[model samples]
Target: MPDLYSRRSFIAGVITAGMLSTATGYLLTRRTPVTLTLVTGGDATGGRSLLINLWNRFNPDVRLDVLTVNSSTRDQYDKFAGTRADIYNLDVIHIPRFAARGRIAPIDPPDGITLLAPVQRVSQVEEGSARLWAVPLNTDVGMLYRRITDKRATDAEPEIGRLVADRTQVRQLAAQLATEGSTTDEAFVINVLEQALAQDRTILDERGVVSTSLGQWQRALAPLAAALRDNRIVAVAGEEKTNAAFQERNLRYMRNWPVWFPAIDREERDKKPGTAAIRLGRLPIGVLGGQGLAVAEDTGYRDEAEAVIHFLTGMPAQKLLATYGFAPTASEAYNDPEVKAAMPHLEIVRSAVEDAHPRPMSAGYADFAQVFRQHTYDYLYRGVQLTDGFVEGMQGALR
Candidate 1:
């Protein structure tokens, strides 16, 4: 009886020891927590807020650090090249440039994941190949914001030269608004480069050759030049300022992106009685703008980084984007009942996005854009004539 009891105790002790050892081994070999850095452009507070919230909700184990480099696409590329950021939210037009320079890694999404047709088409980078280089986060297109009392929105394409001729029409519009008791101080605020690009009049051709001629550029800038001289238009630095001017009800028509819808709605809601009202309308043709997530080729946590990308570009995130007033890259998000309710004119925005054209895609796009911007600024703001020599100088700058 004594020997039997001792043997039973020994057996129990050995079993307990084995279990402890197995548990310890499992814990030792477990995966460690991963930290990823995400760098993007634009308003860090608005769009980044949504992303951070979603990340915390979906990826509790991984740590996400976001940085906003609110400068040019060139600035973003420079940061990505110099920093250790695990992921980059780059402009879709810059994907080819980044991929060509080996600044970003090609992505292979999981089997069940898919992007909208237009976004998917843009996501593919390499010529003559189906390799997806980036994950589309959102889509943007130029839009016109006006007073709700304005005439029914039309798709009438403006004649570039006629619209800016002597600023006569713009001055007349301003006078008409004044007569109607509108407090608007400006008739228009034009983004010359964006307008030109949206109209498919890019400085560089598909072959990366300088394609813009003096006559074409003159037609594009003539309207803006007239407005500047006549004080009928205000030349804003970018969209943020344009949106601000429009929000203050100081301008009649403002060209901006659809992302401003939510803020505009909020302004309307918070306005005091008798404040200026605002409305959104489709651009005749919009310049496509948006960002895509690209993983760093040297990231140690490739799988985790990819998972983060999947979550961001996923349905849940896309739905949140739509709700937050961004144009989502997923087709399903557009059809979402709640999203439609939040943005009544989402259908119009969708149509505009469908018709929008992306900027020129080239390895030298940065240089081309710089040249175009300089020439346009001089022509429109500084009253520089669009001469043959000016065109030659622009072409030379492209080289």
Candidate 2:
């Protein structure tokens, strides 16, 4: 009877030991649930959905909710400042101001991620500083995009002079898009500024103050003033109107960013992607445009929020953005096989980002942008003279 009891005890001991071992393994591998919310701009390229869906599918431990806001920056700042949102994806130009106002917190981007140098520089607290307020998610440069039929635009101009010698053709083609209602896509303020940049001149200096002399401003703006006076381009209120006009075939050329490529491609949905109807080329100069990811201070799940941010700016997300025609800020994305195949003008985009001029930084960047537009609006749209007062108005707004 004693031997039988010992055998039974031995069996019980083995069973208990097995259960404890299994429990220990489970405890070590188990993950705590984490939930985070992110705020971003409108997703015209449809990339936000792709990224969100991917994160939810793979990372069972983390749940990320994304919100898209279409309102102006001011309205958004007012509405979401104290909300439950943990991550903020804002324009690169506004990062400095966002950091200054404490709307978004400075971050340390995860290792193994590389951002475009110019883009990184713009998002810094100071030039060449080790500090960074945000991580650049994507980069942009205004390029001339137009639709073509039958033949490639390259073949059409075998000796294409690029923007240097061939811009005249682009202009002439835009002027001749239609006879009675001929118009080229032109968004106000941005058009004037980009054109000035294209001419190798800038009105606002690095400090966000007006720095151009009267003669320099006039020489740089002569083409636009003449175009407006001659009715060569329409002063559309914004990019939406400009793109709408372009889509309706009322424009042979338009001033647009890389983000609009997806919507424009959809217009020719029936055509093969390899022989797409649209052709894109770079301008001699480009105004840097893009968005960055920032964290909100005093947020719950700080670690999880930053983890999601790392994922968003990581290589996988960058590649997905490239597929949608949005310029990915990751320099490696430009070299990824899938990304290169997705965008035939990859070099054009890369060069643009590399050579693009960043907007002047100021704590009051919004006011500066408005002041610039207000001062240049009449001069650009009404063909009025760009006067000394125009410069003063811009200079005053920077302060």
Q: Go through the candidates in order and give each one's C-alpha lDDT.
A: 0.59, 0.61
Query: What are the per-model numbers of colliding residue pairs?
Result: 1, 0
TM-score of each: 0.76, 0.78
lDDT digits (tens) for residues 324-353 of candidate 1: 567888667678665565456778888877
What CA RMSD would you report for each candidate? 14.9, 13.8
- For model 2, residues 66-145, the per-residue Cα lDDT tens digits are 87766564344545554567888877766776787877766776566677777778887667775578777788877777
| Top TM-score model | 2
Per-residue lDDT for 180 in model 2? 15
